[model samples]
Target chain A: MHVLRPLYVVLALAVIMLIARSFWVPNDFGTHEQGYTYGWYRQSNVEEWKNFTVKYRGKEFCGTCHAGQAQKLASAHHKDIECENCHGPALFHPADPLKLVLDRSRELCLRCHTSLFYPTSQRSQIKGINPDQHNLGLECTLCHKPHEASKPGRRNR
Target chain B: MNRRDFIKLAMKGTAVVVLAKGLDGIFRPSDVQALATPLRFVFLVDTYKCIGCGFCVKACKLENEIPFDADVSRTWVERYVVTSEGEVFADTPKEARNGFITGQIDLGRGKFKDIPREKIKKAFFVPKLCNQCEKPSCVQVCPVGATYQNADGVVLVDRKWCIGCGYCIMACPYGMRFFHPVHHVADKCNFCYHRINHGLRPACVQACPTGARQIGNIKDHGDPVENIIRTQQVAVHKPEYGTNPQVYYIGLGEEVR
Candidate 1:
């Protein structure tokens, strides 16, 4: 009976080790120690986001490379906005170039760009964005370039 | 006693008149929607700065991967030509054709550049996209709940849920919604929920070379887009339709006269 008791104790010890390992360390799927699949996903806040960080909408970077563009963009709605905000996860910027995920769509623009709409006003003559009539074979990039403002004339600057 | 009672009744009658007047304001339909929790974002289109360059059109095509040739375009920018005599006309492509003005490299320069100062009556280019109508007609007519107004007041379509029933296409007075050929479902501008919730601006706003497209949170007092609209006398395209569209254009000129 005493010998059998020792065997049961050893089995119990092994089981305890297994349970402890689950909490104390990470497995292939990830755990408290290993966190999420993506390292950035493990982060808890903007600061913890690791790869992506706000450099003040990168206005300062623009200031260093293109001074005039920084001046013009600084005063617009984009003044407080960060470059990574529109460009998406720019974790591998100049180093990898290709990793720059750009978010481009009219729907994204409508987020904050919707203020100009006032349908009930007495003086409001137009009805909506009227994608058909107003925008003449052109696009938003024709005039506005938030990141570099690299228009043909301003490209060198 | 009689004189005292008569004076009291007169005072009571006056109070009722004043109360009736105050109640009138409650019943008046003066944008009761504003009282409803203001939307997360407000969209603004600065008509004054838009030069009809078609950049928005090209960008939309590339970003959304819309077919190069489809009569129903998800997005396109056109030129609105208003003459001196007050006749307005928008020169939009009749079909979803591409490679327009490829050789035309005069990026809104020369010829009419002088008109901003003198003889030109009112010739301006306004880039247009989906208004994401607040009271979107698209939502009302969708046989399946494919199209709906999101909590933010932006109209969106669940492509997977859509049965390709073109009811929403006809319901929309603005004609912003369209059917996708490959997916065989309804599609339109979703305001890029992918980037927006992640704290990023839309592509058109970022790509705009002229600062024409401005986006902001309209409901918040702190948002700049709200101030831009408040200070400027912006107008919509078809107010008579009553879609309560969110896209606003400042300095709207003559239309299709």
Candidate 2:
């Protein structure tokens, strides 16, 4: 009878814990077939993360409206670069700001073009110049037409 | 039949039934289907091709809504300079957003000194982001169960549930996690989960003009990135930790940790 009393107490405690867990834990808190490899978590968090909105809409989104600029850019040396890199994010553009401001600053151009010699790496392959010696205090766009890369005798070493 | 014989027969019947039920569970068709096509995402970084232009860093900030002026970044490029004397120096000034202009080496604690270009025997840039390991220590150490790896293998944080406990940030072997300035929760790269789900490249991958960064679904049969990962002799960071990092690097230098 004494041994049986301890067993009865444990049984009662288990029942109480089961009921408490049912009330405290959320309905969606369990392992699902979808993400079963990783153990239990709030499954709805997966959907929340998946549904996050993307701000950078890529160059294809820009090409839809700016076909002329896109076409010109495709044939230029800067073809690989996305238009949004210079113009900033076009989040609901034409509906909000009506115009995306263009950054024609030399600093923008120097971000890639400023020479820092790294002989062992492939970065040396890029045509870089010492910013101080290469037309200091002047916007690169003033002398170079970024979109029109085919222009003869306009290439800078 | 005798009582003992009858009892022995009943026990045999119960054992046979239980074995059959267990076998059915093991070979369930739905379970097999789920296992066959589990999505595994992998990222490849070509260290040789990375020019450290920092466009990726700038683009990631704008895309993810992280403040441009913020010191922390989701992804950043580090420049390594190995001297002829076997000394290694590394720095990521402004998270490589402005690009590497000067030859200064960051010695930490608001101190900087220039490394003479003549002493530099080898130099390269390595772009880094969250490894999104198979066994992410961040997920394991999260006291609130806020950080978890999704079906597609990206480790994500439930910002709402996060208690701002820095356990995860400390647990990460890669030092990838950081405190979100605005949300005050642990934040790290989810491999740009939001964009990748929509068939779009991650902001950093898209902004990389040099094609140094790439990502792909390893489960897919003909993915170019996966093909490269399979065919090439790729290396991962800190393999000794046994975290099973998914990020692969090509032409990784000995100087890179």
Candidate 3:
């Protein structure tokens, strides 16, 4: 009976640890709105995560150099979007900026402009062309310039 | 009772009481899972509108700083083309890393050589991500309780405590969860929790040029999410699994997996 005293103390300590854990963990774990939570884990030190170097430097970065194209893109449908969204990331941008790959494929235009099986009401109100009927086997840039794709007077076809 | 017996019973009773009191707050039933507040974030994916441009994929990779790997990406676009003979071919090669345009491009491993349009009867793109279920299996299977459904109804992984057990990865019915290549912990889309908390759209939604993706508070009446759910016919990926996925799809073809 006397020897069992240590075992009982160990069991009690284990129970206490379990109870402490229940209190230590956040209440919102797996619960909605409190956000995700972890139990007894070290927090990710993300103090420096706020201002890390990024690949895509936004439209302003490109606009600084190619003021002519930037000015034209500003008046187009893609005004709100970034230049790097289509042109790829501008990591070595200002140093060797002219080497940017120019994508003038019709498939690129169809990516956003071609309407398919989506409910018409839910689709973007922008007019889409049926590939087979409109400008078949022709480059999209032949009719529409990349900078001013939807501008009224610039449309050829 | 003897003195010893009385002491043992008292200790057991105290332990039980303390445990019940302590766990009561954490282990409450999630019956109010459908939004205790007026804010219910809903993700709408229009399969008809998606053109497999892979812009959303690139945006998510950049926004989350996730290394772009086909197997470990937060989101991927699937291209489904049905033949006139009723044969369906679906593939997501490198999550369309270079954008699915005609020309010289290495479509590594998956051998996703584009089938000519003349042989295809119909084709469309379906973008996939974590469904963020109401009763998420990933959350249930997480041994360490690392994965949890947040208040915004988004399922997220607490990377800090995750043991990299990969249990949640297997448990997810939609096959959304994956082990982060660098972190070695389970990772998946949380509807971009870091951005959405700041009152901005998720990276995928913001990057979609065709307006194929939209996220709105379903609780708000007349909101686009609510209006679509009320007026349009939307379907979830797998309702039979009973995951109750939050991602509602419009024009989801029968061929989509």
Candidate 4:
């Protein structure tokens, strides 16, 4: 009889815990169907996305405000590059035009972009050039792709 | 075209003219022979006109469509401010839609010092970009043949070929290269070759409200653009590195010390 009573109490507690998890036992009830809950959901799923598809194709966000500057970047293949690639997440600004977030660094470009650090992509083996001894202290974008091809003859734009 | 004919032509040609041309060799070695100096392209950044705006920082973002936390900064501008007491301040670079808003400073307010007489009368904005070198260290240091120096003198990396090793990152004297999170490879500015090849200035130059950064070819003698560099006392970042950089800084301040 004693063992049966203990088992019954244990079963009752398990059911209560299950009920608390499913229903409103403070933690679950606090965020139930609220904005805070949805916000949390967004935070968890944000990193899974790979590509950012804009409603207007090729319309750079920075260009909208700085038209003259935008025209310069678009003069060549740079036009194909998406605006957010170097800037970071810009979702808040589109809805609120004045709310702008801007940050930049050469390290950002030198790090992940394989094309800026290596010599050739055709070869299987890829390695980083020690920036210290090779070209003095110059960055790749200075002479190569700064706006357009700026080459003496074969310029793209 | 034969040596005998050339000798005859030389006899007819003025000796003084040839020697004058020969003296040209002593003065301007690069112009002495055609194809003597390799045809290399380079960029020059004029530091004075920078309004301390970070438009280039933001444009790089949209053009590359990079993530917010992305470490790659294709182009950027930094503000150097100094007070009479030798206090220096620099603003964080940003590419906001409104322009560089990282850290705001006002000369009128004189936050650098209290007394107006004691306040710093000289505070200037200096912009920085990739100093495409005549001889790129990144190209030579690349072990896998991934980073290359182009005919125009600019060094570039192939994204498809690069491995995320980051030897270049450690080797860079200016600390330009970075390792991206998603792709996990080395990346940096290509000087917007996509646009420069198209015959346009970079986004930063275009967006600059004060023409602080000027882009031009160093070899085009006929163009008036060459004067800006020739007449100015120019400086490059980390000249001790012996990179022979293309980007030049005019009127460098002692605060650089």
TM-score of each candidate structure, all chains considered together? 0.52, 0.84, 0.70, 0.50
Number of colliding residue pairs in each model: 47, 0, 5, 91
Model 4 residue B130 CA deviation (Å) reads 1.2
lDDT tens digits by residue: candidate 2, A24-100: 87788765443433445787888888788777788899999999999999998889889988888787887865888
Q: Model 3's lDDT to the true fold?
A: 0.70
Candidate 1 C-alpha lDDT tens digits along B16-121:
9999876654443233223355655667877666544444554455445566566666655554444466644444552212212221122232422212213334
CA shift of A32, model 1, Å:
35
Residue B78 local lDDT, model 2? 95
Ranking by DockQ: 2, 3, 1, 4
lDDT by residue for model 1 over A25-142, one digit each (tens)?
Answer: 4332221111111111111221222122322223354456557756776665446454544564333345655555665654343323322222222112221243344454555455
lDDT of 4 at B75: 64
Best by lDDT: 2
lDDT of 4 at B27: 49
Residue A157, model 4: lDDT of 33
The residue pairs found clashing in candidate 3 are: A32-B150, A32-B151, A33-B150, A33-B151, A118-B48
Candidate 4 residue-wise lDDT, A1-157, digit = tens: 8869989999999999998767632231221111221111212111111122321123455677768856876775445444543444354455744544433444433332222111111111212233444455555555455456333224233
Best by TM-score: 2
**How much does each candidate deviate from the true structure in C-alpha RMSD?**
17.9, 5.7, 7.8, 26.6
Q: What is the full ranking by TM-score, best candidate first?
A: 2, 3, 1, 4
Best by DockQ: 2
Error of 1 at B124 (Å): 1.6
